[model samples]
Target: MSRAAGRLKVGIRVPPCDRADRIVRTVRRAEELGFDSAWFPDSQLLWRDVFTTLTAAALGTEQIDLGTAVTNLATRHPAVIASAARSVAELAPGRFTLGLGVGDSSVAPVGLRRSTTAEMREGLTVLRTLLNGDEWEFTGPGGTVRSRLRDPHPAIPLHLAASGPRNLRLAGEVADGVILLSGVSPRTLAGAMDRVREGARAAGRVAEAVPLTVSAYCEVTDDIEAAARRIKPICATIARNGGAPFLALAGIEVDVPDVVDGVYPDLVHAEDWDTAVRVASAWVDDAAALRFAEEFCLFGTADEIARRLRALHADGVRGVFLQHVGSYDPPLDLIEAVGASVLPAL
Candidate 1:
């Protein structure tokens, strides 16, 4: 047997918006930069088709892993999602992971809703079964039907993006890995881990065996406050969805943002830059925003961010994925900075 070499792992998430040229360039760049994976978001109306983008990346790049940073089970059928995931796996071989989540941005635009925990369980079961080429019989419109994947891919992993206690626990029970959305704050991340651990224990599984990927919008900027301001909408989103853990870091509850009441999914992408920051101020004022920057985002100097990242790895974080602020544009600046300073530090 031949021994394989080792490499450092770094994942960058990109949304395939209107620019096909930009997406391809970014993924190719990531591969050149020695990144471990290139993940894409899925929202048919908000961005480009996730599978189409992944397939393109698979054919375009030779080594970098390709995946959905996440796709929603609420919007797509499990059978269909499994088939799409299997097809991508066929292209990339062992480098594809299917990251599933309850619907959010994708469902909101169409006046649909996210799937509940129970729904998620059933959906994952069906998706995994069929992806393994095992006939899975489930009740359809009128009765049950058995089906299997035409091209099975049992190696493809299912990573769940989860935060709420119950849902976090569910990830521990079933997911191959978990995409931690509870923020980078140690307090909240620790709390979220507790929920996941509880779930894993209840399921008779070892929590430590499951890998965890923590994500944040990262940038190296001298003016951290300004960078933080750009992230207000995301802060407000955490508040609106379930801010208890995040709020604990800020020493407050979800009291600041009535401004985000009517916005769908999040105010970050729904409004313009100026309007989004302005509305985010209703909750994330100067002190709060700065605190948010320090505690949650990767928006500090390279030295500072690198130190914290090492601390996160010490805290059991397996890998980190950095998201660019805007969905449509690539974060060349952050990527360059992280590659220069952050990746080496880790």
Candidate 2:
């Protein structure tokens, strides 16, 4: 069925792990299943080229919105990102959003540091200038040069994915939308939104004008305790990376080693998810995992998820993009389950 009026916007995060054509099929299927949007993450080493997958998706789907759940300015220059965004926006018109982040897997493997807050400010200005068909200056080894994107797509919305307080505020000041990496805990979400609104007011913008989309791990299961095991790595990673306070807000506390061995790349995007779970289980017990699931994730029956989503919408969340457990495969099951059961309920 088509989207109904006043229904909360729902999206899915699909990895570009396969061929472009095959990835396009997954996006088309999500569209057919009534998902409002499809977001693709970018990591050169981990997945296929994100822009290629997005381009294919744009051409293959008729009505679904498309976005980079996030791409980075570190691995790719702002000019390159602007040019690529314009290309996809050309194909999809008003259906494309360009999401930016400080970078993680996309930069770490390449021996590049993630962009600093100052760098992100500069990068956003450059992107805005180029995408709006205005000239921007670039300083390089060759020399400083001024350039403008040819056939720029100015209307492409720029979303920022942020979890940290500083970045959350930056998103408020500049982004067309905010992609909250903070999970769905009400206390944590409220605190994050306060920072965003503070920045918006400081920048002389209305807080309500900035749409917010929360990114949370979601599962449809009768036995939530068992399914909660999959998020052990996520809990450990959050605690390891300065989110212990956020976890505490959920009444969950964890302390993990700075460097976890055995999991390739990282815990959040571990290739061997079972192994990662095993490694993380030492720090995060079943009770803690269950707590995380209940607080930060949409884990439960369809009715439960529907109620939680409606509550989130009432609390001013405009959209939410559900992410399945694994990063390697398409969330086909999640799409089918939620679309059939949850969307109609919403």
Candidate 3:
């Protein structure tokens, strides 16, 4: 698709908490609703196996594209990731995209950490080489796995889940697409696009040639305030440290306490609702949270959302991936509303 066409690709970030039946139903519903893509996250021991979930999602849907929003290179070698991506592409043909990231916050639970940006860049280089049906030789901790595509090459797009400046730049320089984390404000989005453009130019690629997909946390409801309150916890945590570069662009500051070194994991593993709210509130205030919710999320009336989304398109965003927070039913409501009411206007 032409960049000017500005596709409105809406899909949910499959939470690790969901059940198998629920996931299938969600994927099927997304496809029926005309959503462009559906992405499942990779968290291994923290959650279900990402490739397995993606296979199920792909098998459940007919038209919607399936992807990893992202699978980290820290856990699996690039060749292994390439093999998995190739397998999934075989299952869905042109409907699979491989979204890679450094790793998720859950890595800490298993006494692990994300790979550095340089490591991620090298990993992507390896992944791209393998995906393009080229043979690669590498020596890593796992001895050696020299390989090449023996089967028919699938048209699987490689997307990077980028939050920091280095990763975002690398994504623009190399990746087919970039997946911005949820809770990004318009200012942040614009700044990210600028960075992507800079990297693309440096790499001798047209700015618009590379697809930019912004993922946001959205909950559609008449009571916008209530929805904002519900979304605050998740957004705050993401804002604090997980996606700090983007949130910093939005002018939201995160005052993290020395006691709680990692804000995101602290919020995610918070024992109760009160603790969760406390943890999230520390990073994001009501005004900032509301602004982020309004600017990033597709909330309020369908007409209002459509109008805002059109404005976003005008601003240069190619597509969106809406992450539904809270209950599954609300996401279904938002998806149906967007497809039936908002997308028609677009």
Candidate 4:
């Protein structure tokens, strides 16, 4: 069952690694540039608090939607998440979305376990109940306690960021929306959506009614082959972590170490991206990187990107939040370039 195509909402991922005011300015700039939404990433050690950034963005901008590209449940308890989501919803009213994901950067650094699917289901149930101004029961060593969030905003949407089969199905079954981590590849996206639709059908929900949002790495460049070399780390990281089949769809093969040492945080969010690319090149060559870029990423000129985005919209992608290559830096250039050139063209 294919979803009927609709207007494609374009959003940008702004890492909240700077001061709250600076982050707000970036979001304001995005709004001025005609971008539909500005998404922020949450990593305690890597960036400033996501809620703090969202709070400032809420007050600074009047129109553009605001959301976490995602925050994780493992690092925060469900009750705390309820309170935070409620607080942000109050600030932005109909514009706030709370996106949750299995802890990656947030938990690995602290030696904490990521949320399991069962845990995610339980957490979503608790969050939904509390955010709707109802009580949720928590069973502990002492006894079962019931608590409800104050100043609840039932309008706040809960989006799940998922890439795996199980989590993707869970998002389809329970979430208000889905943040798809499978880039913009038609083949992989089709497979991921199949899993999602199966789950929604199992839950007796109309699969096409659920909102789909894609997260992809994007750049506005004429020299795509040269630019593709920078994303070698990303290509290798995805293949290393059980996404080789997705790459196989684009006819690219890579073999990376299960554990790649020397990168500070991880291969995807490595501090020295150049060194990371060099290391990953042992497995993923320039030709492979170019194929990944052409098939998976949005790396091309303005016209090229706009055309690709149109294709994605035709394929049932409701929204796409573009990410620049690096994790720490703000996508100011991307926002300006795509906002001026690509958005107007679209």
Candidate 5:
């Protein structure tokens, strides 16, 4: 089946949990409720197997597309990743997408280094070739694998989760889509698109042909302050890690630490709730959160969020991956709300 076009697609990243039945139910609900896609996070040690979760989602959902938000080719060899992706694609045919990324701290805990751009590019090349049913020889520090698909192949779209300019450019050159991280502003999105366009130009392809996806935390509530409070922790952590540079650009001041060494304490160890609120307020305050929610999240009253999303479509955002950072149940409400009120308008 050909991919849909001309409007922003809405998707949600599935939570990592042992309750496969619950996860499957949520995915089915998301599909039935009108989300365009459902994504699984990749973290072998921290979360359940991404492939396994995706398989569950595939079985439970008939219409929604399924894929990894970002899986590292370094953790699993390119051949292994290709095989797993192919297996999942066989389950869902044209509905599977493979979202690849440079391996991060998740693999580091298991004594593996983060993958370099060269490695990611090489791995993507091999995976793409293998997915196309072409025989290929892949040799790395581990070993060599030479194989071709014996079964019928599926048209699995390959997307890269990219943030930096160079990575965005590479994604445009090589991938079917690019997934932008959370906390990006309109200027940042435009800048990233410029890099994507440059890469497409170099590759002799049109820039607009490549899909662009952005991931964000979302919440909807009448009490705006309460919603901002709910979103504080996640925003603070992201700010500490330099994920919210746009906060500074947006003229919001935050005492973000210069270096983030420890994991939990660096984010959670504050004097009081007010401190947490202050640290995160610049990026996650009611108005700021609402602004971000409007621009980045698929939250708010259905009418308001739909208007915001339509504006994003006008601004060239092809897709959004709504991430639930507060309570898990609200995401279900968000899905239903979007389906009942926003999707119809879209």
Candidate 6:
């Protein structure tokens, strides 16, 4: 299952919902649909248990890789995540990647905050050590203690999700792969990749040693204008979080409306997606939404999206995580669309 050095890979993100069976079906379908990986998001109170759903996916399917697009250290202990990751790795063998990140939706509603960059480094160190079956010092509440996994899974690929310069650098220096959150604009991707190279140089390694991926909302439709509008809320969500810097770098300006400020648990977590999309459309508008699609997202017809993806691969992106527009469940139709139209061209 060795990855061809410069080949592009596609993965799908599925939210585990109240119906565990549906999540399993979605993951299996993603596999059958020719995706390279199945990524699950961990937002416990908002969705089904990540590990539980992933376990089900692992048992029901073979061949497709699987992992968290991200889980966080604030909500789950590094040792625990490391152990849980090992269990999934055992199920899929070389197909699991442990993608870690600063807390987002998974923590915010519970009033937990993301870890500082220094804390993230410490967390990764702890997880990597424990997964190698070595004892590591754990510190928190009372005092520091040593812990280790009895039977470790040492070779699981560890990917880090990052957006800011410093975090991107950290990912380059330490991560086996980086899930770039800067979106897919050529300028933004170029800037983020520079940071990655900087970190790799600092760590005394080649920049190409680390793989890179970016997530994009995917839809295959004849109506370009409508699809552009549908991606507005997602574009707005990206704009509010560390996106302003990259937007400025790319000469793109998106107005973040006051209404967006009042949304709870983040815009992407809204259960009533129709309302969320409607509210987002006010600020995102037609011009800005279409512009966001041009610069950030991978939304369009199969041929158009595939051409853009090929450009990404040429520029060093090894993977793309295609996201569905809804909140509670996997968008099965979008999965089918990507499989039929985009996968072949890629």
Over all chains combined, what TM-score does candidate 5 have? 0.84
Error of 6 at 151 (Å): 0.7
Task: Give candidates' CA RMSD values in order.
Answer: 2.6, 1.6, 3.2, 2.6, 3.8, 1.8
Model 3: lDDT of residue 319 = 76
Which candidate has the highest TM-score of all? Answer: 2
Could you tell me the lDDT of residue 108 within candidate 1? 80
Among the numbered candidates, top lDDT falls to 2
Q: For candidate 6, what is the TM-score?
A: 0.94
Tell me the tens digit of each residue's lDDT in model 2 across 129-207. 9999999888999999998998888898889999898998999999888999888899999999998898898899999
lDDT of 3 by residue, 273-346 (tens): 45666667766777766766776677787777777777766777677777766422325766776678766776
Tens digits of per-residue lDDT, candidate 4, 142-257, equal 99988888878788889998899999999999998899999988999998988888889899999988889999999999999999999999999999988998899889988787
Residue-level lDDT for 233 in candidate 1: 71
Model 6 has an lDDT value of: 0.82
> What is the C-alpha local distance difference test score of each model?
0.79, 0.91, 0.71, 0.89, 0.71, 0.82
In model 2, the runs with Cα more than 4 Å from the true position are 1-6
Task: Please give, for residues 116-199, the per-residue lDDT of candidate 6 as tens digits.
Answer: 789889889888899889999777899998878989999988888998888989989988889998778888889889999899
True-structure Cα RMSD, model 5:
3.8
**Which runs in model 3 stand beyond 4 Å of their true positions?**
1-6, 19-21, 141-145, 152-154, 182-184, 242-254, 258-265, 268-274, 326-333
Tens digits of per-residue lDDT, candidate 1, 17-79, equal 756656878888877776777888899887888898888888888888888988988788898
Q: Lowest summed-lDDT stretch of 10 residues in model 3? A: 1-10
| lDDT, candidate 4, at 136 | 84
lDDT of 1: 0.79
TM-score of each: 0.93, 0.98, 0.87, 0.97, 0.84, 0.94
Give the lDDT ranking, best first.
2, 4, 6, 1, 5, 3
Candidate 1 has its poorest 10 consecutive residues by lDDT at: 1-10
lDDT of 1 at 326: 76
Ranked candidates, highest TM-score first: 2, 4, 6, 1, 3, 5
lDDT of 2 at 229: 94
- How accurate locally is residue 144 in candidate 6, as Cα lDDT from 0 to 100? 92
